[model samples]
Target: MRRILVTGARGQLGSQLLRCAEDKGLQAAGVGSAELDITDRDAVDRWVEPDAVVINCAAYTAVDGAESDEAAARAVNEIGARNLAAACSRAGAGLIQVSTDYVFAGDRAGDAAVPYEADDPTGPRSVYGRTKLAGERAVHAELPSAQIVRTAWVYTGTAGGSSGAGADFVATMLRLERERDTVRVVDDQMGAPTYSVDLAAGLLELACTGGRGVTTLHATNAGSATRFDLARAVFAEVGADPERVQPCSSAEFAKPAPRPAYSVLSPRSWEAAGLTPLRPWWEALADALARLG
Candidate 1:
C-alpha cells in the first residue's frame, strides 16, 4: 500500500481527498499551510517520508491578486513546489503536483483551437499562470518522474471547504442568485468545471497506480463550458430562472489579470495511460449540488 501525504489539507481538493482516501484504502496524511507550509524546505523534508506518495495541493490561486503580488505567488507556487520536489527526491518519494489550466495562453485568436494536450507548449498570460508554469519547471527539473495533474474551475459540496466559501464560480453564482435579481457572467473564456470530489478520486488513482505513462495530464471533468454557461447551469440546478444569468464579454468585466479565452484542456494523455476520464462537468455539478444540500 502507498503511504499518502496531501499538502493544502484545508483546501477543497485536499478535504475531498481526505474524504475519499478511506474508500480507496489509502494510508493518508493531510496538512494545511498552517500545519506545513510548502515553502519551508526543512518542514517539507520532515513531512516527505521515504517511499511516500506526496500529493501537493498547495498553491497561490488568486489570479487577480497575483498581478500585484507576484512575489507572494512565486513563494507558494514556484518555491514551494521546488522545495517539495527536492524533499521528495531526497526521500525517494513520488510527488504529484496539482496545477491549473492557466499555464496556457487561452487566446482563441479568431478561429476555434483544439484543447491543449499535456505536452502542448505553454504560454501563460497572467502572473499566476507564469508562476505556476515556473513551479512545473522547477518540479520537473528536481524530479523528472514527478506526476503533474492540471485541472480547472473546481468547486466542492463540502461545507467550509479549503477553497473558501463562494470561492468557485458555482458557489458565487448560487450566492448571487439569493442576493441579486440577475447575474452577468463572462461568456468568452471557456473551460471545463471540475468538482473537487471527482478530482480527488482521479488524483488518488494516479498515486495508487504509480501514475504509469501519465507523466503530465489534464484532469478536468469532461465537456467544455463558459462562465455564462456555468452560471445558468447553477441557476437551473437550484430551480431558479436560468434567464437571470446573462452573458457578457470579458472586456465588460475587467480584472487585473488576463484569462485565456479558450482553456479547455484535453485528456488524451490520461486516457492513453489506460485511466478512465472523469465524468462530464454538468453531471458532476449536479452531484456536487445534491451533496451541498
Candidate 2:
C-alpha cells in the first residue's frame, strides 16, 4: 500500500482526508502544524518520504487577515508550498497541493457567468488570493508533476468546524436559524458550495491513481449558488422557513478581503481526467445537513 501523508491534519479537509483514508484502509499518517511546520524547509524535508504521497492541506487561509498580514500569509501559502514541492522533488514523492478558487478575479464577462476553467487566466485581487496563486506557481515550478486541486466555498456544516474561531458558513446558518428570526445573506457572490467530505473522497481517489492525470483541476460539488441560496437551503433543511433568509448585495457586508463575484469552477477538466463527478451542491448540502442532525 502506498503511504499517504496529510499536512494540516487538524483542518476540515485534512481531517476528512484522514477519515476517508482510514475507511478505505489506506496507510495514512496525519501531521498538524505542531507536528510539522511546513514553512521550515528542513522540517518538511525530514517529514516527507520518497514512497509517500503528500497531500499539503496546510495554508494560511485567513482571507480578511491577509489584507494586513501579507508577509505571514506568503510565508505559509507560498514559501511553505515551495518547501513541500522542493522536498517532494528531492524525495521523488508525489504531491497534491490544495488551492482555493481565489486565483481568479471572479468577474464574469458582462452578464454571462461562465465557470472558470483550470487553464483560465488568473488575476487575484486580494492579498489572500495573490498569496495562494503564488503557492500554486511555486508548486508547479518545483514539481511539474505535482497536482494542484482548486476548490471553493468548502464547509463541513459541523459544530466546532475547522475555522477554529467559530462555526463555518453552513454551521453558522444552522445556528442562526435557531437563534434568530431572520438572516440576510449576500446574493451577488456565486460559487459552488462544496462539502468537505465529498471533496476529500475525490482527492483520495486521485491519490490512489498517483496524480497521473491532469496536473491542474477544479474539484467542487456540481452546480452553483449564491450565499443567499445556500443560507436559504440550510434554513429549509432544518424545517425553518427559507423565506427567513433574505437576499442582499455584497456592498452591505464589506470585508477587508475582496471576494470573487463569480468564481465557479468548471467540471470539464475534472471529468475529462476520468475522475468521478461530485454530486450537485444542493444534493451535497442535504447530506451535510443530515450529518449535522
* Highest TM-score scorer: 2
Which candidate's lDDT is highest? 2
Indicate the residue-level lDDT of 81 in model 1.
Answer: 99
Off by over 4 Å in 2: 109-111, 162-165
lDDT tens string, model 2, 133-155? 99999999999999999999999
Against the true structure, candidate 2 reaches a TM-score of 0.97
Compose the digit string of candidate 1's lDDT tens values, residues 129-229.
Answer: 99999999999999999988999988874334555633666777777899999989999989999998889999999898876746899999999998899
Off by over 4 Å in 1: 157-166
**TM-score of every candidate relative to the true structure:** 0.96, 0.97
Checking candidate 2 for backbone clashes, the offending pairs are: none
